[model samples]
Every structure is written in C-alpha cells, then in structure tokens.
Target: MFSVIMYHHINSDDLPLSNSDTMMDAHLAYISDHFTTLFPGDPITPGSICLTFDDAYYDFYHYVFPLLKKYNLKAILAVPSAYILEDTEIAPEQRLSLKHHEIYDGDNYKTYAPFCTYTELREMIQSTHVVIASHSMHHVNLSEDSVDLEQEIFGSKVVLEEKLGYRIESFVLPYGKYNNAAVALAREHYSYVFRIGNALNPSWEGIGGLIYRVKGDGLKTADELFNPFKQMGYWFKTMIKMLKGSR
Candidate 1:
C-alpha cells in the first residue's frame, strides 16, 4: 500500500520538546532493512512508502540530513518560507511577536531560532535526496476563518515557488486541521494536500482527491522493526481509534 509518513523535529532530548531525531533514525533503519526506499517518482499501493518531514525544523537539517545521506533515500520537507529569514526584513515588532508566541525549533519559549535558515534549506535542496515543499506562508491553520483561506493557500504557493524557484505543488495542512473550504482552496493551488492521521496507507479517496498522510511516531521502537504483522497491527489499532472517535 502507498503511505506518506509525517515527522517533525529530530533530536535526542526525551523531555518532550517535540524532538523525533531518536525515533526518525530508528524508522529509517527499519525501512532500509525491510522495505525498498522510494522517492517522489515511485509507484505505490503495490507496496511503496514515502517519508515526509514537516515544519522545516532546524533539527531536521542538522540531525536528519546525515541519515538520509547514509541511507541514500530522498525525503520531502514541508517548510514555511515566511519565517525562514526572520532576522532580516521582518519587522522587529513582528519578530518579537513571533518569537514570543510562535513555536520555533521545537522550543516553546520566547527564543528566535528558526527551524532552519534559507541557506540550510537551499543546501538541503541541492541534495538529490531532498525535495522542499510548501507548508504555508505563516504556517497558519487553514481551519480558521479569520484569514482568507484562498489567500493563504495561493499566497503561500506563490511565495514558495518564487523563493525556491521550484514548482511548489504539494502542501501540508498546519496542525493537521482543515475542512471543505480549506480543501477546496488547497485543490485550487496544489496538486496534493496531506492531512494528519494514523492510517497505514493512502485511502482510495485520498488518491482521487489530494493526498493523505499518517504520523510515524511509532518509528521510535526498534523491537519489531519492519515486521509486516506488527505494522499492520499498529495500523489496525490506529484505524480503530479513529473509527471510535468518529462514532
């Protein structure tokens, strides 16, 4: 089956600062040992998987890149371009507001460290093992009606495409939040849109519309790494939970 696994920060701290470096490596190792690592041009549903990182965390550039290089696997990075170079041009008041309120580099405090800088993102892009996509301009949640969803969707795509000089066709919903309007807006601008869930593979509906993604947090455990039965069991549990929640 085809799947897109979502990841965030990659770090060693277990104090729960949103770091996943420890788990990410374990997940990659599992994939390397059991499954054939596939890139963007891969065909799935007959058994193919795609690895994706979200939020453009600095830890990803620092910690995740080395592993990708070692495994020779390409992963998609969904980044917000607006906050990349916050030091320059971004107003001081705005910067302070972001630093104080926004979460950056897995830190919840009032620090001003962007997940990664433009240079770092560019460097990652230079590698054949990485593809950068748009998360959004402000990484704002599309579920909110406060901001025009279309503007958020279209503007972010334009900025990313212009800044990176690459066709930004894929988008990930911030906070895994969205609705029909958000979906329609996204469809207008992006070829694919990923939502957060814990399913094993892309549903037939997901493929026909945009795209769907499942979280890869279980990747931390190395005990039954790459075991099909274990993976299926995990997915089964997750689907059951989702179904229960819906009921």
Candidate 2:
C-alpha cells in the first residue's frame, strides 16, 4: 500500500500551513530511512510514499528543498498558476510573512511575493528531487458552479507548462474540495488528481485518475505519522470510503 502526505510551508514561524525547519529535518530523515519516496510519474509500488508540498511557498525553496536533497527524497511541489511571480528582488524573508489567501490581492505584489517565483521554480525543476504539479489558477474553489473550468482547470495547466517549460502531469485541488464536474475536467488534462480523502491509496486499480491524500502537516514526528492506531484508522476509513463509494 502507498500513502500520499500533504504538506504546506516549511518555515520557522510554525503557522498552520507551515512546518519549522527542525521539524522538517526530522520528517525527511525518518521518511528517507524508512520508506521509499515516490513522485507522480513513478510506479505506485507497495510501501512507496508520495511526499507532496502545496502552494509552492518560498520557504519550500529556501528550507524544505535542501532537506529533500540531503535526504535523497523526491517530492511534488504544487504551484498555483497566478500567484507565482515572473521574477522578484524582494527578500525571501519579507515574502514569508504573506500567506496563501492574501496572495490574491494584486496590491500585495508591490511589497513581497508569497508563492515561488518562476525563477525559483525553474531552478528546482532542474533538480532530480522535485516535480511540478498544477494547483489551479488563482487557487479558487473549483466546486463552485460559477467557476470557469477552462481557467481553473485546463488553463492552469497551459500557464504552468509555458512558465516552467514542461508538461504538468498532476492537478491538486486548491482546498481539496471538488465536485464531479471539477474531477471530470481534471481527468481530461492530468494523469493524476490529488485530493484530501484521508484514505490509503493501496493501489491504482479502480482508482480512476484520482490519487487520494491524507493530512500530515500536523504530525510532529514520523512515529506519529505511522502510529499503528492511526494507520488502523486509515484502513478503517479506507474501507468505509470504498464501501460507501466516497472519494
């Protein structure tokens, strides 16, 4: 069985969407020693783990990325199409104060940028340890009936590919919220669709194009991440979700 762990910022501030550098070191050390880490295009071999970071925060490039390299682990960094700046002179520290939601304001760019810049992303993509995934344009909630599927779904793919100079193979729902229409459109463009369902993706069989993910951001230690009881909860919920036909 395989599991996909969702993460956000890797900063010293310890915000809700972040993990400190120390905690991140612990996570990578333990995960590297224990399980085989996989990425989107890799085979879903048994016992493989997919370590994915969302929003492509600047701290990820500054902090978590080095840990990933030191540990020799692979990770998928999800980037929202619009938030990524073309280039920036702002200090990464100044940018760190900005959070995901606040990035929507165009006025915010005058000061600092929160998300990864195209320059930074290009550097990471050249490395063997990272792969890019689209997090949609503007990070909007795609389940909304008023949302434009072209811009939020396929349009994001086009933008990222143009900016990063490669095809993006995966789509991660901005808030892990989606409906049939959203999922259907994502399937048309991506090989994988990552969403929060807290279930173990034991295999790709009958999985459609969807790859379910569980929250691992709150975990302080790898022991807590794979606690037997918690793993049982995953198994139990996996059964329930499969039985109920839930995604």
Candidate number achieving the greatest TM-score relative to the actual structure: 2
- Tens-digit lDDT track for model 2 on 1-247? 6788899876535466667788888878998988899877678765689988988878888898888889999999998887788989998779877665565577785467777889988888888889999999978889888899889989999999998888898999989888899999998889888987777875653244577787877566755778898889888877777777667
Error at 137, model 1, angstroms: 1.4
Task: Itemize residue pairs with steric clashes in candidate 2.
Answer: none
Candidate with best lDDT: 2
User: Which consecutive 10 residues in model 1 have the weakest lDDT in total?
Assistant: 92-101
Model 1 vs. true fold: TM: 0.76
**lDDT at position 215, candidate 1:** 61
Specify the poorest-scoring 10-residue window by lDDT in model 2: 201-210
* Residue pairs in collision within model 1: 10-21, 11-21, 58-115
For model 2, the stretches where C-alpha displacement exceeds 4 angstroms are 12-14, 99-101, 205-208
List the global CA lDDT of all models. 0.65, 0.82
